[model samples]
Target: MKKFIYFIFGGVTFILGTIGIFLPILPTVPFYLASGFFWVRSSDQAYQFLLSNKWYQQYVTEWLVKRKMTVRQRIQILLILFVLLAIPFIAVPNTWMRLVLGCVFIGHCIFFIFFFDKKRTRQKISSENKIFFR
Candidate 1:
């Protein structure tokens, strides 16, 4: 029963994450992460499929392993965030809401600029070090 529930949730979140690829306002990573979480708990096959997927490899696994994004990736994410938020920032009539949107934009900018792209030293994997797929 628990595994069944997890599988169902994983499927739902995976669909959302896939949809998010085409919809800028809907975030891709979070949904993918959620799907991965459920899949890992429920079905190893599903989790492995996600791990081997090109999109997941490019977007989620790279970030998870490296803890940083390339400049181009960072720029793309920022631009999407800007475009998604800019419309509301401009069209919203409520002053407080506009202020909130502006703040959110600024916050996203700061995070992607300073924090998301931080450089880290890569440790050399020696022959003795085994890389686990899971």
Candidate 2:
């Protein structure tokens, strides 16, 4: 019964994550992470499937393991965040709210640029070289 409930939660979150890929306002990572959490608890097959998924590899696993993102990925996420936040930033009449939104945008930009390191570590470099030379 516990496994069954977890499986259901996993499936639902996975579907939401998939939908999030096309919808800029909806966040993909959190849902995908949640799906992975539930799936791992519920079923090995489901967990392995999530591990093998390209989206999971691109968005979740890389961030989890390396704590970094490719420039393209960062840019893509920032653009989507800007588009989604711009509407409220423009429409809100209160000066305080607008200021808050501006801060949020700036914070996101700073976080993406400074916090998410772009440089590849030596471990990653050596691993890639090994694969390439083989």
Candidate 3:
């Protein structure tokens, strides 16, 4: 029963993550991470599939493994967040809400820039297997 619940939750999270890929308002990475976590607990097959997914391997696996992201990846994420956050920052009429959004945006920028390690050249990801190693 517990495994069944985890499987259901994992499937829902994975679906939401997939939808998030196209919807800027929805965060893609967190949902995927949560889905992977639940799947690992409930079903190894689901976990393996997610870990092996090309998109996941390209965009998330490196950060998961080494807490690193390429310079390009970092910039891309920042740009996406900027564009997405702009909606609430500009469209929302409430000054306090906009200010809150701005703070969150600033916080995200600071954390991403200051905390994550820069991806090194030696961490070349193999195209076929998507494996990265020093």
Candidate 4:
């Protein structure tokens, strides 16, 4: 059943997100977002819980309502990518392997940071709004 799947996803996301909080490479926010959505579709309690979470409330709150990302979030994501993806290549022993992995990682980050993140789009909108409103 769909509901069962959501419950399972919610549990997994919560666990992974919780782990992400402690481990820098794991990324807690995305898992939280995933779990929260699962909860949203599956149970009112889960939706309410995610919405109420003090750590996650800000990102999901305005974004869910207005579909925006804050400037701080944008910067944070770039920083995370730099730390997690870029740094790892230095340790890779094989030159070709390093190059390939680095390129893939760069591509992934570029796509996610540029195309996927709503905050960047929101920033553009807000900037345009400022120009028009001013």
Which residue pairs collide, candidate 2? none
Candidate 3 lDDT tens digits, 38-130: 999998998999999876775577676656677787788788888888887888899999888889889988888656734432344343246
lDDT of 2 by residue, 35-126 (tens): 99999999999999998999988778787566767788788878888887788888887888888888998999988766675454656778
Q: List the residue pairs that clash in candidate 3.
A: none
Q: Is candidate 2 or candidate 3 better by TM-score?
A: 2
Clashing pairs in 1: none
Candidate 1 error regions (>4 Å): 120-134
Q: Estimated TM-score per prediction? A: 0.78, 0.80, 0.71, 0.56
Candidate 2 error regions (>4 Å): 119-134
Best candidate (score: lDDT): 2
Give all candidates' CA lDDT scores. 0.80, 0.85, 0.79, 0.75
Best-to-worst ranking by lDDT = 2, 1, 3, 4
Candidate 2 similarity to native, TM-score: 0.80
List, residue by residue over 1-134, the lDDT tens digit for candidate 4.
99889988998998888787677788776888899889988989877887788767654555454555666766676677766655666776778877887787678667655664666777878899999998
How many residue pairs collide in each prediction?
A: 0, 0, 0, 0
Put the candidates in TM-score order, highest first: 2, 1, 3, 4
Writing each residue's lDDT as its tens digit, candidate 1 over 1-134 gives 99999999999998898888888777788999998999999989999988898878876877766565878877788788888877887887889998888899889787666555443223333322546432
Cα error of candidate 3 at position 122, Å:
12
- Better TM-score candidate (2, 4): 2
